[model samples]
Target chain A: MPKLIDFKLILTNIPDLLQYLPITLGIVLLSMVVGLVLALGIALVRLHKIPVLNQIFTVLVSFVRGTPLLVQLYLSYYGVPIALRYWNYYNHTNFNINHVPAFLFVFVAFAINEAAYNSENIRGALLSVDDGEIEAAETLGMTGWQILRRITIPEALVVALPTLGNQFISLIKGTSLAFVAGVIEMTAEGQIIAGRTFRYFEVYLSLAIIYWALTVITEILIRLIEKRINRFRVAQHLVGTPAPTETPIVGAQVLASKEVRS
Target chain B: MITIEHLAKKFDDHQIFSDINLEIQTGEIIGIIGPSGSGKSTLLRCLNLLETPDAGTITIDDQQIVAPHITKAQRLKFRQASTMVFQQFNLFRQKNAWENVAEGLITVKKIPKDEAKARALQELDRVGLAPYANFYPEQLSGGQKQRVAIARSLATDAKLLLLDEPTSALDLELVGEVLQTLKQVVLDHPNFTVILVSHELGFVQEVASRVLFFDDGRIQEAGTPDEVLVHPQHERTKQFLARFATQTVHN
Candidate 1:
């Protein structure tokens, strides 16, 4: 039988596949930015338990989270245009589905999927902020938005960072699903190269190595960011740093004869 | 001056406190002592509208808010009039000591950054935390954190300051330092009124001008510490004092 894997071809295919990295990175970065913004709104709506909008978001997030990403891609690709066409016809607008770029469907599908998961992360992080801190801010006479901006969001972001980094990395891998929408991203390009070369084992091996490297690189960068963000916390746990005391009020005031330690 | 009249609060079917009336003069240090779940903290909270009373009128200086009828403007005005020091020493965890002290000044009172920083540093110095001003809350001992909390309250220059169990969360060694700082605060800032909720009868007797003994969701006894702490009138008050006395002796 022929060799199950051709090691030479795997080495040669590495550069050809590496070029597709930008396509994967582009989709992931765009989806992350859009997804994070939308997630904030969605998280707030549910957190405040707004009258009706919260329930609508509940259904939307549930649908996206419950279904498979591939199915979501199909729905975005096929379903969104039909819905938009009906929307245009009924509203008497001259909009056309052809005007929407095909790749936009992939972006929408991945972005919405990431939003569904990240909203929970954001919401949980915000909720984890101590009730005492919120009370402290209020007692300090800080307005609600000021407290959110200064106290709540900063503390919550610290709590949410690692989880958010994990979600972003997952989203990077998730971009491989973009091939479902006919987007020529990394995995899609790999498939085309493999079909032409008939060296499936070598091409597939190269693809795996590229993805492994991407995951490892993303993890290292995220760790560095986390360390920078939590630098204060790092200093907090160091021991033997003597607490320096300010001088007593009276330069010549004698200590009280009776020390009240009760 | 602070006045609370016919104050009431209820959580669903459980009544927390009702018809609570109090009058505090400027510079008065009133100690509140009670068993757990006596609504002492809630009473303090209602003064600043932190926990809106179901029925009552709270007046600080001239701004008065009636329960269930307070406007947002009135709420803000009332909240601005007082500051609270929590048992947890709820210094903003993300901020260092100076920022925690200066945040209210810069954001609420619109003080200039340079001026607020100077004032914050002075307050930190007052609390004997000058050198630790750059440290985060988690870096400081519980006593240091409480001192920072006290400094933050003092820096706001609020007419009334409420402290809920300031030393209850501290180590035995730490409690003495915090109590000393508090005594200094009362002596130095004679114009600032204080309501301290505490379990340390010795400290309360030493520092407070008056003591209020809370029981059954009401102030059963209110008198000079000599009367309330030394010469209790009500049977419940005597029982409560007796229990605290034994606990202290055992400790």
Candidate 2:
């Protein structure tokens, strides 16, 4: 810990790390957005549990979940080049392996990985939706799609949000993996600075510290959101219903914050 | 508003019901009575296309909901007119009572949000649950929940309501409150149809304009309560009535 502690090198790299913050955040943001969209599609496919599509998602989820993240990144970065040679051979076009940017491989790999994990998160959320609720929606004449959007998805979002938040924070940390693919993110930029300045311990310690700080921030943010959602609105009828509300007819304490009505 | 012709439903190898035919006139309240194993539920579900008949056709409000190779979209259109209220009152757990009520209106009828909410409140009020509008089903009592279920059906503006033993799940005192809600609604709303399956004869007599005595898997006798309960023709009808009459007296 003491050998690599040059105050000057650490100070210079701290600013550099801050500069790379956008690159790190940008990748996290971009991959998460694209990954979530794909995840929704995959989640839907799994939810409907159609014969072919369910099988596809099953295989896809298992495959992504089974392999290590590092390997997935390495395969995308190294393997895509060989695959494109086939494209080049067939199309008679000059498809240089080098032209395939490092960022693209990293993004694609991250997106795929995020989608796999998020799909499982979302699918579990969808399943947790009460069957009675869906049946009630059915009686209301809600189409299958409408039920998913109106009651099923929104309710699932309440359940899925926390898990998704965790994934997102992990995803930001997962951006560290992007360093392997040569995409210049905060973790990687830290690595480059550490190697150059021979202050390996300080640089890595800084990276670990930032990641830990981020995790803590996300945890606090998620907890705040959970509280806000609870505070901002109780069950629709819960509004003004009163504290230690009338023992509901069924004789259970049902989250009755009646004063707060959406 | 509904017609059933030679309708039959079989669950795999077991024939649940067969050779059932009935004409439900517009605005008629018919109570379907039967024992535990009887196919009263299967019949009600068939009318709404919630359970497809193995053989036969159901025409509701002059539209065929079940026919040879009918499209699901067309069948769903018929479901809009008839809502089935379950014995356990399967209100959506995620939604509050009002969302449960407004769901069909907004989703199937494409009613606007404000309009749907307004209508849902009105229906809940109709069932004496205006205050419980925003309450989730889990929060409501067995009686309150059933009223919400009834309100959900009413909110859709469905002309026909199918109660599959609507009050069977409630306790002695609770049952009357739900039945009273239904009775009040019946008195106030004209051009509404109700087909109920129940073991409670007094309730059947109170709400059903006519009653059918079912035994095994078929309708053994069909007539007004005076005819079926008071002057029954079938042995099974007589048997059911004797039990019902005694139970009513004791309860």
Candidate 3:
């Protein structure tokens, strides 16, 4: 037999990969938190189009999305430090202690970049909301903020969730870029192993499997979320067939109530 | 009372209307009878400022109805004064019928929750939808949806209610329940004003004090129902009434 391809090697690497899991999860979790906050700001800016800021936001969103994310990471790690160094000297070398942390710079780059794309997705979802829905809310006299909280974002999230889920899968792959900034994530650790053992194939294969498992698990979680939000849609179609329509909203409320760990 | 003077609307290449003038006296039901592209829906939408007309003056209860456009703040306040109900029902699918009706009252009027629910219950009772209050709009029939919509409008305490083809989506049997609800509103309320855009001539005659027959986006015939519907001077109005008569015959 062709030397009994060492399944033992794959099994051994599983524990090694597990060690780096927290780092990967941390980057992704941090990126999503920062991205979501920025996206909400950008989304509202574009959606409501608050004066001159709207045009600036559109350009910003377009510029960020139009470029490759890898290039953005490079610009932050290399470019921002140069700006910081100069600004520090201008402030009498007070900033010589590094104005931007490598992790922080990477986080900001990924977050701002993700927010640009997320704002676009979120804006599309918000726009797809029928005018009647908003009108109904306004007529009910839901204050602008209340409507945003009770109806607008809740409904927009349902549409954005799937697209957001896809983006998160991309984010898993994206955390690999954290390796460039020496973040000690899965891919970074994999690189260390590969360099020491000169075992390029094994190390990279382990990295791919870990990323794949994360994406798969995230995908399953997203489906459960989608099923819950789609309760209203399901109920709407069940015409005259005496089954519950409130299931979808109730399910959605349940999901919404579940505290997502930051 | 609502007064619309020389209201003109143009969209893209085609002009919708050039010179339209009308007045809606308080407690009167005005039915706009028109062909498909005659701007009937646009006219109704413009009244509540749902659609922005190019150049016109609208006065609702002497409020000047002018943002000349529906400025966001002005529009919000205007929405409080009037409400439009589409044939589509336009109920929030996420909310139940009672919540849908109570929505505007609690939000716009800033009524307390207990008071809003009480008022919503009263409004629902008026529309004969008290039983379906807890049920969602999705659970109700088309007639029931329209009734809930009426309850929602009533809960807002709006002076003018615009109905866009209200019964067009309902079954023949379902149509009566919705029309009856409106009739009850007309009989009981003294200050309420109604504008109904419908293809149902029999229903229009039963409700409207005055009928304006429209063709090609202009009022072709305008008078009392007896003058416009029965003794139509315009061939278009005669043709329209004939089509409804034929539709009735075929069914």
Candidate 3, residues B1-251: lDDT per residue as tens digits?
Answer: 78888898888989988778888899888899987889998888887766678887888885775535656776666666778888778787767777888777666677898889888878887886565566666656788888888888877777888888989888888888888888888888767888999988888898789999987878888899999999999888888889888888999
- My TM-score estimates for the predictions, one after another, are 0.89, 0.86, 0.81
What residue runs in model 1 are displaced by over 4 Å at the alpha carbon?
A: A1-20, A195-200, A235-262, B71-73, B110-115
Residue-wise lDDT of candidate 2 within A198-245, one digit each (tens)? 778778777777778878988998888777544323444532243333
Instruction: Compare candidates 1 and 2 on DockQ and give the better one.
Output: 1
Cα miss at A119, model 2 (Å)? 3.2
Task: Report the lDDT of model 1 for residue A219.
Answer: 92
DockQ of each: 0.41, 0.39, 0.23
In order, the candidates keep a fraction of the true contacts of 0.57, 0.31, 0.27
Better-scoring candidate (TM-score), 2 or 3:
2
Per-residue lDDT of model 3, residues A177-203, tens digit only: 886664687778877777877777777
Candidate 1, B4-48: lDDT as tens digits: 899999989989998899998878999999999999989988887
Q: Predicted chain A of model 2: TM-score relative to the true chain A?
A: 0.81
Runs with alpha carbons beyond 4 Å of true place in candidate 2: A1-12, A88-99, A158-162, A225-262, B238-251
TM value for model 2: 0.86
Q: Docking category for candidate 2? A: acceptable
* Order by lDDT, highest first: 1, 2, 3
- CA lDDT, every model vs. true structure: 0.86, 0.80, 0.78
Residue-wise lDDT of candidate 2 within B1-251, one digit each (tens)?
A: 67888888888888887888889888999998877778888788777666777888887776775554667687667778788788889876757778888878777888898999889888887887776765666556788889999888877777888888989999877888898998887888778888989887777887788999887778899999778877898888888778777877896
Q: Which is the better candidate, 2 or 3, if ranked by lDDT?
A: 2
